[model samples]
Target: MTRRTWPLRAWTLVALAGVLLLSACGEGRQSVLNPSGRDALLLYDLARVMFVGALVLWLLVGGLFVYVTRINPREMSRRLAEGLIVGGGVLFPVVLLGGLLVYSLPLMQAPREADEGLRVHITAEQWWWRVEYELPDGGRVTSANELRLPVGARTGLVLNAHRVIHAFWVPALGGKADMIPGRETYLSLLPEAAGTYRGQCAEFCGASHALMAFETVAMAPADFEAWLAAEAQDAAAPQGEDATRGAQVFAREGCGGCHTVRGTQAVGQVGPDLTHVGSRLSLGAGILGVEAPDFASWIAHTETLKPEVAMPSYDHLPPDDLTALAAYLGGLE
Candidate 1:
């Protein structure tokens, strides 16, 4: 080989080695192949097989093109034409149907059982998710924008949409499931690891669709039970005159029209159920952190944070009224 060819070949080998190294190092719970749930893993396997098969077919077609055009261009006549026509006509339909069947058969088979699994109903709005869980004794725990699941246990999800169409997808645990308005869709997720996983609304709902996000907290069994019980209990009223004044403002003002807190007179269901608001990690549909200043800004002027939102801005209220409402709402844990 030429001296220059030796260097070029060495660089190509190095580049290929780097790519292999990167592929080897790519490992995570959210990875398509290293899935945390059973159905997700099965789907991953099907996609992988189809991907590899398609790549091989593409390589074969490329080689065929090169051979037909270069080495056999003079001899490519009636026989070659017939071979190309027959091969082209027969290959695509068979490959596509085979791939479709291989990918869809698992979904068509007998559904996986989740007899003892926890059941949660998830409703997706334009840019947020409202999650409700039913306990064993017929009681329930409702939260917004966050989902808590028990690690190593099968969890069944009943999904729907309140306003527009949206898709629920938590890459760590499963695939995308559509939440259609007025119809219920079911999916099962078994989280084997304990961590906060990011989830997003996969469908284009509205302007804030890019910001439509949620978090899945996979806790230990004991911790999950404790959280469930805590969420199910009635919300405690805040103590002291300042807190009392805040509560009065929360009730007197129109904030009670959309939000809810158990044991309080605010039982509106049009928005999130904030029974344990203070204990939650974030607020404003996970757009704002749970903090004093963030709460103040959001409650004062929600329209600024989300343009054209259904909820109106309370910026017209008096400064004291805004402060009192913020304090009271922030204390509902």
Candidate 2:
């Protein structure tokens, strides 16, 4: 058989062309190599260039082996051995060291300047997210499960954990950052467009860690301001006779032991604040939709959906009582 250099080069070019075509499609949402932030995109480009260069090196070395082995069997003993050593010993280290240097360069540079517009604190708990926003007027508001920010503005996030380790990440916005118990970590992201982004607890904290999800809503500045105002309003309890009965059940049945809703009593910080939960996008830490049947099922039997959850089943309640309670909680908006 004769040595062939054409095949190796052809394959390398084909792979490169495929990558270019994928990039050209602007599949930012689906592309692994596509990056949203300036820092991540810069790093991704450098790494991709290095990867292509490495593939070319591999092809050239492999082609050289084919050349020596086939063209002259007599010289193969010496030439092939020397080629193997030189290629393996010299090229491998150079490629590895080169890649390391390329990846480390950006780490030494100072981080980008912090944007003055938005700042929010995120704290990870056992099975939920605690989000706090620092407003321009020096006031702070805290909520759970859902995060709302001004669209197109650069936002700085400070991450912390109350119990165990967790990772905070929103794939569309940026990469992940660890939430350590005692240490605070910071990440900055700018949502280019206004929409909803889904995120989860990347670290395994406990049994319900997978259920520990959160949602981010990026809205226009005017809309965001309106949302903030609405969230800050005092709680308004349900007024109808059925809703009044439901409120009585909530107080009698020990629902106040874990959750909180402003005014009219029921203040327990162990779980999420239901003061404006009806107005939020989703419920149960984004596990279920905020609809009548979903809420009814979840309140009636949580363990059936998620085994060993902190909240036990309220399965003993009668159907009418369950319906009334669900209606009352739904009216919290």
Candidate 3:
């Protein structure tokens, strides 16, 4: 190729790569820019305004620098210099900053207003989330790894930590609130659309902190009500010989000491509630999908998927027993 053509081709490749990289940031379900809730949309709007304001400020500064360096000092008047100093350096910044503070302070306080809709309690552990929903009858339903909400409902989340500090953040929903030990914090979200969003622990807690993620599903009012009803019920009885045998294995393996499944003898409260484990979209705090193969793998090698996790590996179990156990858990839906 000719030299001119080669330079053109190189520029084209660089432009293409830049476009591709920018596209990746726009496509994720967890991106704050693609907000789906009222608070998130407000934050997104503020971000856009600030971004544009920064660009304008940069251009003005650059222009001033160019004029100063290119023009002769003798040609510039003393009044012009003083005007630039006061206007650009002091008054301009103070006005801009004051306006921003005024605009954002109210948004920060909006979440603190009373919420009359659903209330959820989320407790952050080393690498997982314990989710509890307050029912209308004053009872509570507990679950893990997945959070469900009604679209267009103002849901209040009461957040706390079981051990160390963590941050509960779902970018598409709203801003994050810290989950601190010995203290309870709150965040309010009003999802505007029905879709699935991803959430993660924004603060680092331990070795598996990066894997401490969950899914947030926003459904219609009717669908959300039905889901709540099902979740409030006890786990269904295991069917068939394989599933029955698997339930027996689960009890014999001492899995009941850390986990709980309603309507069963397993009543341990140290781990995530597994009453509807099969109904969850993902397993192990969003590390893997809820499927037969993934379930078996998680059971056989918990540490391999999540390092420094509290659960022990059950690789010593025979292949048949493992398969049966996986089958039984997968049928809990």
lDDT per residue (tens digit) for residues 89-141 in model 1: 46664776577776777663322445467999999976678899988887678
Residues 165-246, candidate 2: write the lDDT tens digits: 9998776666678999999888877665677777778888888888888887878889998888877776786879777787
Best by lDDT: 3
Q: In terms of TM-score, which candidate is strongest? A: 3
lDDT tens per residue, model 3, 1-333: 863365457657976997898787874679997899998998988888777776677667755765575433346688988998899988887887787778878887766665988999999987899999998888999999889999988999999998789999999989988999999999989999999999999998988999999999999999999999999999999988888999999999999899999999999999889899999999999999888888899999998889999998999999999998998898888
In Å, residue 205's CA in model 3 sits off its true spot by 1.5
What's the TM-score of each model vs. the native? 0.83, 0.78, 0.91
The alpha-carbon deviation from the true structure for residue 163 of candidate 1, after best TM-score superposition, in angstroms, is 3.0
Error of 3 at 330 (Å): 0.7
**Global lDDT of each candidate:** 0.77, 0.75, 0.88
